[model samples]
Target: MTTTKPNMHAVAINPATWPRQTYFYYFTKIAPSGFSLTVNMDITATLAWTKAHHVKFNAVYLYLVSRLLTTHPEMRIGYLNDQLVTFDVLHPSYTILHANRTMANLWTTYDTDFETFYQHYLADQAEFSALPGPMPKTPQTPNLVNIGCLPGVHFSSYTPLPFKPLDSFFPIFQAGQFKKDADKTIMPLSITVNHATIDGDHLSRFFNELQSCWEQPTQYLA
Candidate 1:
């Protein structure tokens, strides 16, 4: 799969005019730390839709989260060229486990149109899903959020630490195996974010929106 690098550019925010300036300063300077929240999302509707449409759950999962991330400015905050900025869009840089038990890093550029993005994801998987390596299948853009799945485990809590200092502001997403809770299907989703950019209120709003999406899959998944 040959493609040109995305015209990725971060738009710097004026700290004086930004509403989260104090929170960002306190978190990044006085007490630097990140936070993780894990929620059991009801994916029954999403699963049904995917099954009926013969769509891959992973693709839909990624698409839903990416859409939300791009929608929320707090989730898009990152440092670019030493300036705090927000990305226009965030791509999904996800992991694919190979038959040999190794993992390959693959990513697809996100599009507002679901079909276009879904087809890109399918193409990426078709070309590099089996390749076993730590290297990324495609050239990664600066505007990317790390995403992966642990299909074998359904843990109640999860917290991922940042491996790079620069990645501290970017959100990391993980989803666990789907399990049944009564008549509903539950998927454990873990979101790790820098407190400097995201707060509990922001995270709560994100969950609310995500819940709405899962409850009404036809809105976007269709």
Candidate 2:
């Protein structure tokens, strides 16, 4: 796919002011992932775009997600080491399944170009699968968001909570199996974010951006 440089900075943050400080106390008590929000979106266009272009769905998904996350810094803010910290460059870490049905974590940094990000994504999968039972929790850095795919099942809504704690600020995204809903091919996408750190407005904006980009793949993904 063709691409252009991103409008945001690659890796730099303004330490002078922390945008989410006001919600820190609330989030700390409510649990980052505890009182989180999950939204299921219709990504019919997303599936169509990847299939038409012969691009890996998850790879394209990670790229699109990274673009959105980088654009919204509030989603990337997390409480680490007892201090509120924002990442200069928050990458994506996804879960990959093995032949034995086990899962391993794989990570890839932010790459503005979809083709390059896809290449690195493939390499990371191969590199991680070759070795180890359960992969390490941490990837390239703490400034990484969690993204995964659940191609086997299609669900209306899902929460990655029971497994993760409430205070976990890292965002979790998963794409489910696509099914036909009348004439349109619809796919389920769930995004989980901390309630205290991020509000509904941020999520609404993300959905708006995603819908726009998916509707016009050639403009954004191409």
TM-scores for every predicted model: 0.94, 0.80
Residue-by-residue lDDT tens digits, candidate 1, 1-222 = 675365467789998899999998899889988889999999999999999999999999999999988789888888777778988888888888878888878888888788888998998888878766786575667787887899999999888754776544878889999999899999999998889998889889999899999999999866
Which lDDT values do the candidates have, in the order given?
0.85, 0.68
Candidate 1 stretches greater than 4 Å from native: 4-7, 163-166
Alpha-carbon RMSD, each predicted model: 1.6, 4.8
Off by over 4 Å in 2: 1-19, 29-40, 79-82, 136-138, 162-168
For model 1 the TM-score comes to: 0.94
Among all windows of 10 consecutive residues in model 1, the one with the lowest summed lDDT is: 1-10
Best by lDDT: 1
Highest TM-score: give the candidate number: 1
